[model samples]
Target: MFFVYKILIINILYYWHNDCFTCIGNINLYHMRTIKLLFTTLTLAVLATACYTEVIIEDEYIDEPVLNVHALLKSHELWYVDINATSGNREVPFLQRAFTVSFVGETVFANNNIVGIGKTGNGFGLDVGYFNTANGRLQINHDVDGYWSLEVFMVDNNTIELYDSNSRTSYYLEGYQRNNFDYDMVFYDNIEYLLQEYDVWEKVTTSKEGLLNDFDSENYLQFYIEGNRSMFNSSVDPSGMHLDDVLWDYSGEYSVFGVYNDETLKTLTLDYDFMGNDYFELYVINDSTIELYHSSSGTVYKFKGKGFISYLKSGISQLDKKRTKTEYGTMKVVRKRKI
Candidate 1:
């Protein structure tokens, strides 16, 4: 009986020890799982904050004003004749008149001659100056009485600045257009004086735009003269007067040319009768050649420049025998004088 009781007691004690060990293992595992979950949550929060991105930007703006521009004209000589009042259906002197004139505005005639924009009560008056601005380009003003005037500015060797009677603005201009002048903007009057004064620009080659004329700063001299065909309305083919020959003087105030015509087989012919169409056309071509077109006999003609006598010889040699005059000796000299 005593042995049986001792065996039962030992068995009970062994079972209790096994249960205590099992409880300790369960508590350790739970603590380890809780620590792992907390670590994962902290890692996810950090990653979410780091994944976000940022962006930035800016803006732009500009401001400017409107302007009005015009090209003006001035002339010292004018000629007028009466064609309808001639006697015997032949041209007779009705009136030989001459006067000083200055004109402006647009020139749309086949001749490109235009009215002056600066026409005053007595003559042409042009007011050229500049206005100040808070910023940007300076304002150019042409305050003529008859018309609103604007002057276009250009850049050249000289840095253009704006100047009027009282003040020179911070801006400067190199060139502008006046009735498209013979060379358009290629030759601007305002910078002519400056270009002529600068040794660096002096003797520079000319282009379609203009050359640096060392003589007159206000003139962009073309190489050609202006004239009209004298035979366009004559008893001859009328169209036979289509010959053009006149060397122009861009530096001069006016260009005067005597009317002369010839055929290779004939002698030199001079035009005595006067008509309105008799005139000279001066203009620049390809910026290099100064071409002259004469109007006479109701026809228009073109001529090579006076500076190139060799060009004339080449041109004359290429003409047909009928238009070549051998007996007239040397062709009469044509001079382009300043007005």
Candidate 2:
């Protein structure tokens, strides 16, 4: 029984260590958000908790204690790790404990006895571990946003050295999306047709949810240019929202590296600031619109950015193309200029 008590303490400490980190992390990094991925998972874990009821079995039957760690670091918030005992005869005996993310950095959160009481799936409770009074589900506030990477240890004996950016919260981001922008530029002088502006983000895929930029039709996208650099608004969350609505005038700036693909003349290499974060790669559509695809989330954003260039840009003779006014008092593209 004494040996069993030792194993129990080990299991509790492994998980509670994380909780202590969380408690300390919350105090130290109050400016950062407390993002929780486990809240959604608690539903199933809570159901499993009903089967458990503090048992102290013979330590002789149990094997060496093996610990498994799972940490999810997102949105520039607190680091969290789920600690569990793996190589034991009793399945639930290993139990589930969580510690703050700092464990990867320091050994301070090594202490255990952090317990969550009352409901099994509920937040921290008074019965165990370091968080004897923490309650409710782990929460991540909406306004709090940003991202960072960490060396996370997982149960499968592998380490994820990197993570996705904050922009990819909606999609299942893959590793390829984390590449840096460093390469030779491919400029096409004649492809200035892309500089014209319009609200080109029309419905593309049928998923409806696929469209990330959903600004009002009347308040379409626009671009302001000076030299090779241009400026525009960084897309806000909830899609369809405009910076004006939030009284924010945060405009993003990007350098025009010109067309990236010589053969297609459709791809543009732009280095742009998205609320301080920079990203690259844009595609031109029939000399009318631009497209940006975030590989991580697999989301494609379209921007009319500017109106179509004048006759000088189209390389038309002006005589071949005729513009006429319709009865409704709007100009129509009746015909294009030819050589």
Candidate 3:
């Protein structure tokens, strides 16, 4: 059947092309135009179905960045500077290193252009950082916590111009997220009946940390307070270093109480005492960690304790601005727990 149809179509084309119905000179102008139109239509139909194309579209999503500045000044180490740029250019390797990191004291961030130093002695621009120094040669030793402001000047090799100073950045060397909890605990309340349901918290490991991210303990320090009785334990030494202590105590004497700031922000105020009464602003990090922020003396204590199913609900992972992260000393609470 298919071969019969093919033969019929071929005969029809042959008859039309050979002018079996219309001769070349005798054919009407309209008739010739009509045949040409049909031929064009057939050619178009075959061409349309003969080719295929696959169009590919590429797309990407970029999140808006949160710009911040960080500078950690250690006692006998180089000061590491990080200027965080969310959307703009981050680190340019072609720029030269910082020529000077002057001691602008505590008010340098606000002082604006207090000190100035450009590139030195025809040196090529590459990488720039701050070392713990005072007069360009003498090493400066200082115990700086919380946020300290500084000024930086970089000569861009691309444009041969000074880097933009308008990128107002803050130096928050403090590692732990500040005030990481939403719920408060009361040690001397009628909730003492609930206290019996909870176990006493103790230190988990015997190691000190230079940074909150450096906290690597098989057991994290734990603390609990019900009524006027509070107990705490840690394995941190006086030098703020982690160690294996067979004499570490899990429970100590202390009572704590706390309150929620408001329903809007839900800030927790936990007040407790061991040898002396002290309070902390709580910030929650996750199910296993929280930070204790002391605003007065600029101190931060990061504690990781699991099993607080009731209190560990909301997890705010971002670092707080008020918390001191560059704690050169050991965990303050554990160091105080040395009694």
Candidate 4:
């Protein structure tokens, strides 16, 4: 019995020493040693009892904090609508059209205009609607699109999916702060849409270095989305004329080509119907101005954008606006005098 008790006491001391070592840094080293010494002395006195008592160790479980949907929605200042990542055939009109959306208190803001994307509302754009969250559902009451209830699914730390059951559509959004967001990418990727936002492009300056051509006679230009085609209207209505008062002398289709996949540098081709096509290198001077360098005549023309349109509050949804691709072939070059 003495030898058995000696073996049991040794086992107990080993277990106590291991447990005490766990607290080496947490507890003072001297205090841990003192605790082990005291525990060992006590265990020796109650060796028989300690041998009979079975020790069952259990792991303590910690519950993860439940994520609040409202807090997550407002965590980031801006949520860029990843329209290309949309998973469903159907789409939420407002979300499909918006470049970015923000949730601030009860107001819902959207950056619908690519021209004024980074500069407008300091990157939040305009308050186009209101939103409320409850029972893990986000309810949006848009000024033009009406009401919509969506279920939010977290894709990751910075990505989310707003799933609309009625439409069976999922709109993916990536969160970002205003300062860190890539505004230039958005501006160039959707540059075609920016052209449609202006009511007219009025000629402000014409460089005299290049040879004067038929394009010099054109003073006012208008680009509009018609059905599924990108259309342009050119006028010789002179400068300083009201946008609505300008008389269009020519109307045809236009195409924008990327120069060596560079977004900043683009070539615009004007299909002048039977008058042949005119090519010009396009340059964005500012938010409201553009420079066009004529390739044929080496003339440079600067046009200022007029009448900015924000599609968010304009009551125009994405479905209402359409764009289509057109293929052009070699046509007979015919130069006609401006009538």
Best by lDDT: 4
Tens digit of per-residue lDDT, candidate 4, span 1-339: 556766876797689679877764676678768867876676577776656767999999999776678999998999998766787777788887788999987999988788788788878999888998977799999987899999998889999999999889888899999989987666555667777888899999998768878999999989987766789999998899988899999989998766543445666789987798888877776678888888678788999999887675555444465322222232233222111
Tens-digit lDDT track for model 3 on 171-204? 3121111132111221112122222222222233
User: What is the C-alpha lDDT profile of model 1 across 204-319, one tens digit per residue?
Assistant: 22223323322212112221212322121122111212224222222222223222441211111322234222233333332223333332222222222223221112343112
Lowest summed-lDDT stretch of 10 residues in model 2?
169-178
Arrange candidates by lDDT, descending: 4, 3, 2, 1
Report the C-alpha displacement of residue 242, candidate 3, in angstroms.
Answer: 10
Candidate 3, residue 169: how far the Cα is off, in Å: 59
lDDT of each: 0.26, 0.30, 0.30, 0.79
Candidate 2 TM-score, true structure as reference: 0.25
Best by TM-score: 4
User: How does each model score on TM-score?
Assistant: 0.21, 0.25, 0.22, 0.72
Give model 3's TM-score versus the native structure.
0.22
Q: How far is candidate 3 from the true structure (C-alpha RMSD, Å)?
A: 20.7
Error in Å for residue 113 of model 2? 71
Alpha-carbon runs more than 4 Å astray in model 1: 1-38, 43-339
Per-structure clash totals for the candidates: 52, 23, 27, 1
User: Residue-wise lDDT of candidate 2 within 1-339, one digit each (tens)?
Assistant: 444544765676568767777675555443233323333254345556655679878667757543222223222122222222122222111011212211222111211111111112221111221111012111221111212221222223222222123222111111111122111111122222234223223323222333343222222334444444455443333334543343323455534433322333233233334434433245555434455544333455565433233321234311222211111111222211111
